[model samples]
Target: MSSTDAPRRATIADVAREAGVATSTASVVFSGKAKVAAATRDRVLSAAAELGYAGPDPRAASLRRGRSGIVAVVLEGHLRTAFLDPVTTAMMDGLTDGLADLSSGILLMRDEAGDDAAALANAPVDAVVLIGCSGRARASLEIVRARGLPVVVIEGEAGEGIPRITLDNAAASATIARHVRDLGHRDVALVTLPLDSDRERAPVTDARLAAATVDVTVERLTGTREVFPDAPAVSASGSFIDEGVRVGRLLLADPAARPTAVLAQSDLLAVGVIRAAEELGLRVPDDLSVAGFDGIAVDGISDVTLTTSVQPAVEKGRAAGEQVARMLRGERGVTQHFTCRFRAGTTTAPPANR
Candidate 1:
């Protein structure tokens, strides 16, 4: 054949012909399955190069294998929120490390408020990891379960037949509360994470308390009450620094009714409370002591380290990954609970005599 009329492109059949072998042999060589002589393999490779033929199509291979080769990591909040929280980052890093053996890749799926569960239901994933899921996350999870895919929830409540990787949120919060109480702070206020999707910033009432959908919020709130039954609780829109500042200002505004100590749900919130205290010209631990959860590093706050609870976020993710691997191996995965350590920082001290 003339060069212009040469075969438009090399097909598997062309490669087999050029290699002087059966088409099935060429297929086996590309598939990397079955034992082929090294010389035959080299011939197939050389023939494939000469014919300009790429390897077998991945879509076709996936179809043959009956697997998507993808894992979906569903995030409860916006993507930006996940990036801002160091806990989420550490957990993700651990999960990725655990999944290193898998040839497939992880796909991030954000569960937006008001979106249907169809997206997750139809996603081409063999397994799923629910990251920081709240009550709204349950609906999508149900859909995933219906599809019969193995699921692992991180820092979420355990469902019937579902394995969970949980943190000691209550114990940690109680430990912090006990520290404040031991320091002579009888009156304490709480700045909590968003209780539900509405994310309203206001005083938490009986109604809102009953409506709380996030597991972490509920457990931490319960933990605090275990120590201070009558502690006043305020709900913030999120664990953001600005939200902390706003809620902190509100709680500390009233001199007569202000709490001597404030318990924020996350370190970011604690920092915001510290800023609000500075704005009001009140000295931390002397005017008001503040404590928070999550042992994350924050900048700009010198000598005023926050007394907080530190959870093994990366290890939690690693445990979830290991559980997923177990499920993939047809073994029932065990639920793992991690404990948090109470960190005494400079942000908390005895309440000043009023």
Candidate 2:
């Protein structure tokens, strides 16, 4: 056919005509909302493929249903860091699996909250899930709520009207401390997650402790204090191994002021502490004991397993996904809480004097 006389661009009406079905049937087939016979659905898909049609137009579908079929996952830091954390990875996996049945896709939105709150206010999402956010993130979250979208906060608490998916951060940390106390380690130090975006790395002082804005940091620190009221805590800029190593070296450098045990907020941090201990010629458990949270497997570290609290990362994600699904189905979604179990490993043991 001549260029001007070429066949018309395919539309849902054309697909419906080719499939010998009504436009509504064709829409249902593509949307997968209404139950259609398997054969009919297959016929609609085949017809659309033959016509080079890319199924329903998202713009048109969104207008018709008043929904975007997209859920935004608001992350607090760089995308690379979000993917590195086992906790975030596990939760994302579970959320993906849980939403698989719904055929909804996830849109990862980074909430840096610079100059303006444009991203949070303008995201084309029907709902949002806050992943590991704190401090200034709370302000962005308020914007998300103001936009009238349902929100689910994971690993952080949301005030009334927003649903929360929480882990027992305080109780779990306290449990880990109690384990250390039971091992007869009186002198202990802590390596904490970032208390704020300032990413400060220094000895956790009373002022720093009071000014902490991160919920996880606060909870874990509170838990540690339950046992070691005067435990010397140091804040790490992040949960990365390098940060852990830096904090570890600083803590172990001064033998005169070093503690017998170290409790890191993450497995990666714990591994760093172990490396630091070895660099200082301190033997594991024999001279120092270290413990961490999250049971993620670490590589290249031999003969030493981290003593940590094993939280259900994937399960937490799945639960969040299920909650999102419930909200979409016109159900009153409820908050969920999970706990971590302590895993005694080679990195921790009785104090050297024993």
Candidate 3:
């Protein structure tokens, strides 16, 4: 029991010997880089447990494999804000599930191109996933490309030669707009997500639309415009309830100028619009019709169910993760397109005046 008599620590080779398999087989069992038979995997695990082999240390494995074994998830703006959106949260959950078997870790980085460029440039990650990135964040892509890292973007455009997990933003928004128009809502207004990385909370103007750099914002706006060509629209600073409230107040303040209906780009904003309507003694649908995108649960905000187009947020994340996995395995770039389902809820109805 003396220090000199201490036993040597077990390694993958020892585990492989105990399992009657090659070291490569044992390594793949732990690394998850390749597929092995279930029975063989079970035997390997049993041997590791018997020998007190706690699998491979990630650091040592990364050194041996020349990979970081980490994936960086780049989000636009503050990390806190990204987590607040239910859609983003759902997507992250799915991404986690999709990347689970890769034996990879997730590192969240805020893509403030100018300020964090150096940090992102130096981050130790085998792959990068851009989630709902804006124009400012898109500028950081050059740095990522310079590093020769594999890239996947969810709900954002990344130009050619890059894999993108995209939604039919324009088509979905158009569906919502058409529904509102079909309800005989002639006087309608549009509330939008931030049109640029500046996150300006102001009325939508020709200058801002012309200067828009966010693809999702632009696509959704284009969809709405297709149905309500002359409708007045306001852009929210962010995709939050308070931002929606600010937009709602600005649009519904004056009864003489109030629209009969409002189409909000997000469910949270729709809830805010309803709040503004109630504050002004206007009943939803009966006095003011409201519609929202993103089929997230809006219960407890009001009794009214939100009429919206529900995109597969989790599936989008999974698709991005799958693409990243493929790239890590030396596959070429791939792209995936997802569609949304439109559900009519209690929030949208024929305007009383109509």
Clashes of 3: 0
Report lDDT per candidate.
Answer: 0.87, 0.86, 0.88
Cα lDDT for residue 324, model 2? 85
Please give the TM-score that candidate 1 achieves against the real structure: 0.87
Please report, as a residue range, the 10-residue window in candidate 1 with the lowest summed lDDT. Answer: 110-119
- Candidate that would win on TM-score: 2
| Model 3 weakest lDDT span, ten residues long | 297-306
Candidates 2 and 3, the one with greater TM-score: 2
Give the poorly placed runs of model 2, Cα more than 4 Å off. 1-9, 19-46, 53-59
Q: 183-263 in candidate 3: lDDT tens per residue?
A: 898999999998888888888899999999888988998998999999888888888887877889999999899999999
- The clash count of every prediction, one per candidate, is 0, 0, 0
162-216 in candidate 2: lDDT tens per residue? 7788889899999999999998999999999988878799888888878877898
Off by over 4 Å in 1: 1-60, 112-115
Residue 191 C-alpha lDDT in model 1? 91
Pairs with steric clashes in candidate 1: none
Task: Give the clashing pairs for model 2.
Answer: none
